[model samples]
Target: MSLIAWAIGLALLLIFIFALLSPFEALGWWAGWGKRGLEPSPPSDEEMAEAQETVAPYYIVYLTAIGGVSAEDISKRERVFLARLKEALPDAMIVTDVFPFSVTNNPLNGERLLGWLWRRIHQSRMKRSLKGTLFGSLIFLRNLLQVAVSADPRYGPINNVGVANEIAKSLVRHGYPLGSGAPIVVMGWSGGGQIAVGVARYLNQGLNAPVYVVSIGGVLTDDPAVAYVRRLLHIQGSKDKFPSIGDILYPGRWRIVPHSAWNRALAAGKIITVDPGPMIHTGRGDYFDYRATLANGQTHVERIVELIADFIRPIQDVAQPA
Candidate 1:
């Protein structure tokens, strides 16, 4: 065979092997590869200033969990948690918006040749044994490719920790520190909690403010991406199995173990753990409701509110002149 024909055959063989191991559908869903709508820009300067004045003492940037699509898509439990936040922090301003960060809705479409190959990979069980070996290799390759193409995963489930810092810079440009030098609270439930970790990392890198982070049920890990966000607080219920088990999220790995370790390391520093008591073993999506129960059931929201209030008061008190 000619050198050109041999090269062509070799290329085809490699592609066939890859398809057997990892299908495009699974790869796309996991990595969030390809195009997605851009995130909406931050509130305008005028709107931001108004929000600053209205949301004095604190400004909150809330990111939703995986596949959230928009803030309106948040679960009933989250709505409940936000309601509690509104009542508890009457003086603070809360800006809630949903961000689109994943590309799972559409099927994969590459070059026509690759597309047909992908279809075959999806259709064949004969490829199973080959798939078992290729699966791991393909996933690693795809993940690397996706990360190389975008700072955040193409899946758009978790907040892109890197992009989240840009949002914070925008906040600062719009005078977020305010005259009070008030603290900024970057809050998220599940996927959003991952963004909160990103935000803390962002702050630690350049902009340092008294930002108190709260992850309802975020995956915690020892990865360097989360190293800077040391000042974090995580709340998980006893019943929520999610805190212990990983999800089929964009990044694949969950943040629970990292959170547990973080809590242990910070045990001597500023970490504080708050348990909402037994409810169900759902996950962070259930935080708002579980917390709602704590708020209105027996202890009432005030008790928990007070705990948060106490956590934040010291900063405000320290800012005040004697």
Candidate 2:
């Protein structure tokens, strides 16, 4: 090969290697990506019959957190409010124990030199100093080279929207196939909020039924996807950090307040905002306390449950002649 051709080939090879080593491919999974393996078996036949008969016109969806916490971790704290919800709406079909989606982990292949070169080209940027710049760049390049040899195909592109659609379809197939006639309320915390927003947006196109979505400490953003959930009731607490208001990339690097700004926008709307009191701030852990009511005359947890009920309440109430 000509010297020029060799250099061009080498540069391309390096870019490809870097792409392979880039940990950004792991973006799809995030913290809560593969938390749940698969959908649990549906309630028994008798339970289904009972659910159909007793469950109200509303569907209750509980979205799990993506911080690697188990569903049990969620239920332990939120059970008080969930139990109250169950009691208030006896026939309501409540579905918890479902995860966001399955993430196929695709590690880089480390067999070929060209592959290694490809991986090095795709890594994060670095500085200009000997230690801070060159050293870091070389380390990143080396890591990319290692990963390029054995790349996994599964991590190519994640269909988060598709996962949300599947969850919606499951709700229809198992519970109310006819949605407009019934109401559906979805509540998710953290990353679960992202998936819940996707499900409601996709389903809302077909079924105009009142779809109420309440996200606690959810990672809400101003992206096109989140715009659909704008009409859905969204609640954000004041203190919880982590996934606070939009993409929080590089902690302490440059704080971008997308989620916080979104909350500000909602505050100007007709949606009811509930403060979950000061317990541990973020909606993570067992902070779903129903008793902590803010001065706004509403308890964060209880108000959430009540919102679900009120949202599903028939539209003919006030219209009825007194």
Candidate 3:
């Protein structure tokens, strides 16, 4: 074989090896071997009491991209998007924590082993070092594997529950009305889309509340969580093609498979798809780029934030306190 062919083959082999080893972290967490985050816990008495009182109009838990290292480690565009979203929905509680890739919600640079390496990679990324992108791929691939675990029937149940616990804890921590039948909208970007949908079933029952999922170019599997989600809005851009990877990888997402959960949700009108003009998955002209201007004269992030805010806005008065 040619030298280039040999190199390509080696790369594929390494990726396969990485995939094979990806589930160990989550497995260790479940087996009580990892020390980053605790197992799922029920709501406290105080949290239950807080659930009864009046709360924010609605909740929005924003899940970051797979490139994310920690809850707080987000891109400048993402931070700007969250800030803009908060301004757009001042009455709604917007949550930016809850590392979507970790079943225990443990960040890459958290208490887990090999954290020092991840910390350095995160720092390098902040400095915009080329080496950061090189090292960040490892984190990206790690989270990507977790996404696959969430979609795999063999591991999804155990994994999804752990992630759901994290989301539940975040909501309760932020004073979400648990038993109040209030609504939560999970705005998941990229890989987070799958996670946002994956945890819907548990979140729905855990808090006795409704859950909505808004996927911004999310890679989703045909998990049963789709059935439990109150509503799912899949917003994609015409120029983006990465989202199609999910469709290609998961047979259940294929149109020919009429019986899959994703298809069923589509048939029942539980899933809504929107294409907000031209954009790509990431980088220069990606959806959240602050400098990427659309034909309508709106920045990429502005248009998307508006769409998200309008979709989840409530009818009742959602004004701020005096």
TM-scores of the candidates in the order shown: 0.54, 0.52, 0.90
Cα error, residue 179 of model 3, in Å, equals 1.0
Please give, for residues 82-140, the per-residue lDDT of candidate 1 as tens digits: 77777766655565652412222222223333546434443342255666435334332
Output the number of the lDDT-best candidate.
3
| Model 1 vs. true fold: TM | 0.54
lDDT of each: 0.48, 0.48, 0.83
lDDT of 3 by residue, 188-300 (tens): 99999999999999989887777899999888778888999988989899999988999899988999999988899999998988898898988888889889899879999
Q: Report the alpha-carbon TM-score of model 3 versus the true structure.
A: 0.90
Model 2, 53-83: lDDT tens digits are 3323556677665432224434445677788
**Each model's total of backbone clashes:** 16, 33, 0
TM-score of candidate 2 relative to the true fold: 0.52
Kindly report which residue stretches of model 2 are placed more than 4 angstroms away from their true locations once superposed: 1-55, 68-73, 103-158, 179-181, 206-210, 247-272, 281-286, 290-300, 303-322
